[model samples]
Target: MRKMLQVVAISAALGLLHAGPASAQNRVTYKSAKTETSYYQMGVQIAEAMKAGTKGDIIVTLEESQGSTQNVMEVRARGGDYVFTAPPPLVESAQSGSGPFKDKVDPKFTEIRALFPIPSLTMHFVARGDKGINSMADLAGKTVLLGKGTFGATEGEKYLKLFGLEGKVKLADAELSNAVGALKNGQIDAFVTAGSWPAPNVIEAAASTGVTVISLTDAQVKETGREKLTIPAGTYAGQKAPIQTTSLPVVAYATTAMKDDVAYALTKTFWQQKAAMSSGAAWWNGVDQSLMPAITGKIHPGALRYYKEAGFKLNPSQM
Candidate 1:
């Protein structure tokens, strides 16, 4: 619930000048991903913190969005006050006008600023347990769903290449629900779903039938060049033991136009309220200040000030 705020006068535009600290929009809109995903839930918690922490009267409202890649465009157009993004890698792609974003990404994407590095959201590769598949490479010569809903297809392809199965596997892109249905009917041999702790779809997949969560070995993870995260035992049924897997690093960001004090307050509030948010979603447990963004998106001045004052060391390149 958002606290009722006394309406502070708002202008039609709040063009924050890049020469120095500029005026910010007191009334802010936070754009997140689909309601069912972990990104949306975290967006809600972060928006609430933004609303709760401001010393001056400010309104921070959260809205569901298509995906992080889309949110980058929205933020660029000044369509919202804040936005959540895909892994640091994706953001880097969009910002640098490379990879999936090569021709379509806006040049202004560089103006976006990093608020905080969110915990790595992991995608689990699940297959019908009877398939006898134990790892990503096992899918060689089999049908698989790359899960290109929000995360790009390119990353999925990269994972395949790393496993030395790119040319060996037949891949299809589908929505999560449809992909799950396809798996149940044997239309596909395996599918990937990204989630925090216990990714709900993976649970549904296991409940529907015998399933195996395909994990990557350290060597495979190195080959993929993606961060590895552990899915603890019991996170999903039939997961008798912890498994190591490659994961995505999501980042929270705002425009350079956002004021320093507001950024500082919002960042501080999010960290302080982590425990409370965790009670509702175990995903909150992934929030860590030390896990700096691997991509080159510069930190916002306000957030950087708070981190420095709080004594958190940051990579010099980020400053």
Candidate 2:
């Protein structure tokens, strides 16, 4: 009896020694935009869908942050699994080492990997007619408000720099809601903001006072190397022509620490369920894989793997 018990104990010990490590659970925390905005809502919907679809292998949750710069900062500091951002801010941050990082390029800047891109928001630069702001050239020596956790501010600054208006203009920082009142009150000369067609604040300010939506000339667009968009006719109260300006792509990003399989599964799940996602938020519209990489910088190897396996052609830069 003692010999039999000893043999069974030894056998159990051997089995324990040979057993592979248990599958590590994947907990994905998505840092999204502010709570009241559509961006945040989209993140919530995606999180819920992924959580439901991933079964038990992955745990997904959503939280809100200030905007692009803050989201990027959080992703690095917290080691978050995913974050939502636009190409302009990311590009600007990497190039200037400004924005949230201010004076220094974040050490984790390279860890930012573009997963996929969604539809973009059009940037609108509105100036009170009395402010003497007429064209991009007129912005020199004026105060312009740019962005609110959005790319308009960062990209707008780039445009100013390109046009030789960097030191000439006062770049004021204010939220979109407050911008309308600020412009009406003459607190600032011009404001830069981005969003879908007919940004509500622009319309509201226009109704109360004469406001002009500054469009970027073609030459200016070419110099920035960013995507161009047109605010179509009848988009605003008095807009008569299609104003040409630049737009930024809203994209998903993952860190370098994320595994290829996890990024693959997450990317696959997003596309597979995007059809349903669009039904909830119109911003999810036009999430075509083909055009996403056009502006979004480098695609993560893990996400690139999924895109390639799914039969998508990626430009050399994205690869």
Candidate 3:
């Protein structure tokens, strides 16, 4: 009888142990529409920071999606918890509900909050130095390769249309390497891409084939209404001097549905360990904590909590 009682007690203890609240685990997934190197690097940084800060309580998985349109759609559909996207298209999609989305997103989606602002990506029109393509207007009637499956292409088209070059140039969609190769092979007169300083493909292609990155004039910048940014001298491998051109903004967004506690914890950890991320990749080198803008979309409660604790003004719209 004593042995039986002991056995029963052991069984009850085991059951209680098994029924104890399962360790709370918060897992979030991040998706990037296009596989830009910078986006992927940033995702890696975030994942590492989350893991370190959560002490293994939270796990973050990052993957590549089709692009901004698909990423925003999936996030709205609750298919993803976070995404990296450009501000222009994300804002345009959320506001107009037009284009690739076709009215699928709610205008209130503005609740999607910005985590940080990436450096302005400058548009580069690379051509063979001997090709004699001196300016944006010189691509007329020439077969030009615009970036494929990336924001560069979409934004390029918009700017081209704004500049009234819509029908005058033959646009071909191709990957950066292929576009550069086409230029090397003389199949295309020019290739257009927008990216951070020292764009790897552009630098490598120019080094191998002697290509030139054209600068946009002040008139062109004003006409386009985009911010003009300069690629400082020595940013690229062989560039002799600073290159000035109009730039487009790139930003990362976190879903509102993400738990506020987790977002707050992650944001706090990220800023505290900013050096960890900054030192991990060249792209992160220029990220400034002060430049992280107050996003328009729904801000994560956790982020708001962190901001308030830090004594920063918590704007009503951000909340």
The residue pairs in collision within model 2 are none
Top TM-score hit: 1
Ranking by TM-score: 1, 3, 2
lDDT of 3 by residue, 181-268 (tens): 7888888888888776667667777777777687788887888777777777776665787777776676767766667776776677
Residue-level error in angstroms, candidate 2, position 307: 1.4
Candidate 1 lDDT score relative to the true structure: 0.73
Model 1, 207-266: lDDT tens digits are: 887799987888887877768788778777888989898777777787777878767776
lDDT of each: 0.73, 0.73, 0.70
Question: What clash count goes with each model?
Answer: 0, 0, 6
Off by over 4 Å in 3: 1-25, 35-38, 79-89, 95-102, 105-111, 119-121, 132-134, 138-143, 164-175, 308-316
Report the CA-based lDDT of candidate 2 relative to the real structure. Answer: 0.73
Candidate 3 lDDT at 270 equals: 66
Give candidate 1's TM-score. 0.79
State TM-scores per candidate: 0.79, 0.65, 0.76
Candidate number that wins on TM-score, 1 or 2: 1
Per-residue C-alpha lDDT of model 2 across residues 71-95, encoded as one tens digit per residue: 7666557664665565545655764
